[model samples]
Target: MLIGYTRVSTDDQHLDNQRSALRAAGCQRIYEEKISGAKRARPELNKLLDHMREGDVLVATRLDRLALATRDLLELAEILNRAGVGLRSLGEPWADTTSPSGKMVLTVFSGIAEFERSLIAERTTAGRLAAKSKGIRFGRPPKLSAEQIALGHRLSSEGTSVREVARMLNCHHATLYRAIGTYITPADSN
Candidate 1:
């Protein structure tokens, strides 16, 4: 049995071309989804895997359509191999896992992909460290400005109700409390 799998990254993309090709390839069953290949879980692919039996062939239009990551592809291949199922890619002849040469090619590709990912991660970390050293801040900005915090502290010291001060500053009482620290007692703050 030749089982096909088709995938598109988003709903805006059509699966017609892949489906047509899979059909032309004489696929009796085809599983498809419109979701990012980066995602770890794919329901349709899982279903196909569960449905596949020994001596079956899992076919995809392209290697990327089947899996975006080398680890994921290798894991899928392992599962198929364990089930005595073969894998074939219509676009990449070197991706056929049924042949020894194809398997060797896939192993080399996986190694290259892993190395590429590590390099990307290393560069990203280096970039982040450089930016941080240059005083570049990341994540959400502070809710209250320095001036507002100073004003809040002054208002709290002057015995004004925290709620009233928060209202005057157009901020939540909790925000005022966080900015002003524990300056106001709970009874007076709330």
Candidate 2:
């Protein structure tokens, strides 16, 4: 059985071409959806996958119709393969998992995808380090400014309770303790 899956990203796009191509390619049952390939959730695609059984071949008009990323495509292929089902793309004949050469091609593509992911990770780490060296702070800004912290220290030194100072600053007492540090006396620790 050749089960077909077709998708269109938006209302403006139509599934007619893909449906026709899949039909011409001998698809027995076609599942259609109007959703972006970037989205992980596709009801029709999920249904089609659930409906497939051993020896069934999952077919699509093109590789991109199934998934936008190579990693996603490879994941889908792995799921289908694990279920004893094959995957085929009408646009890319070399993508047929039912054939030996096609499996080899997909294997090579899988390796390339992994290498690409590693390169992207390395580049991202390096970029983040460079940004940090340039004093580009990430994440949320501190709740208290340097002046506010200094004021907190002064208040703690003046025998003001940590709770009272935190209340004045509109923050938690723990926040005052962290900012004022050693300025908080034994009595203030309570």
Candidate 3:
């Protein structure tokens, strides 16, 4: 059994061409979807996978139609292999998991994709380090400056209520407590 899967990114896009091609390629049952490939969940694709069994073949018009990312494509291939099902792409002959050459090609592609991901990670880390060296700070700025925090501590120590200190500093009582490293106890407030 050759089960076909076709997808278009948007509702406005048509699946006629993919449908005709899948039909021509001898697909017995076809599942069509109009959804973004970037999305992880596709109802029609899930249904097609569930419907497939051992000795069944899954066909797609193109590799992009099945998955946008290399990792996703490899994962789907692994799932099919584990289930004793084969994956075939009409546009990409090397993606046919049923043949030895196709398997070899897929392995090589996986390696390349992994290498690319490592390179990206290295570049991002280096970029962040460079920015930090240039005195560029990340994340939210402190709510209170050092001078403001010292003033808050002084006011709290002088029997001022947390709410009154917070109002004087133009910040919340929680922020004032965090800045001063202490809350005003009932004895201190008195």
Q: After superposition, how far is residue 117 of candidate 1 from its true place, in Å?
A: 2.0
186 in model 1: Cα distance from truth in Å? Answer: 26
Residues 118-159, candidate 3, lDDT per residue (tens digit)?
A: 999999999999999999988899888877877788777889
State TM-scores per candidate: 0.60, 0.76, 0.70
Candidate 1 lDDT over 3-113, as tens digits, reads: 999999999999999999999999999999999999979999999999999999999999899889777898888899889999999999988988999888877876887
Q: How does each model score on lDDT?
A: 0.90, 0.90, 0.90
Candidate 3: clashing pairs of residues: none
**Candidate with the greatest TM-score versus the true structure:** 2
- Give candidate 1's error at residue 1 in angstroms: 3.9
lDDT per residue (tens digit) for residues 1-190 in model 2: 9999999899899889898888998998999999999998899999998999999999988999999988899999999989999999888999999999999999899899889999999999999999999999999887787778888888878999989999999999998888777444445669
Which segments of model 2 are wrong by more than 4 Å? 24-26, 50-55, 79-84, 157-159, 181-190
Error of 3 at 26 (Å): 4.3
Give the Cα error of residue 122 in candidate 1, in Å. Answer: 1.8
Better of 1 and 2 by TM-score: 2
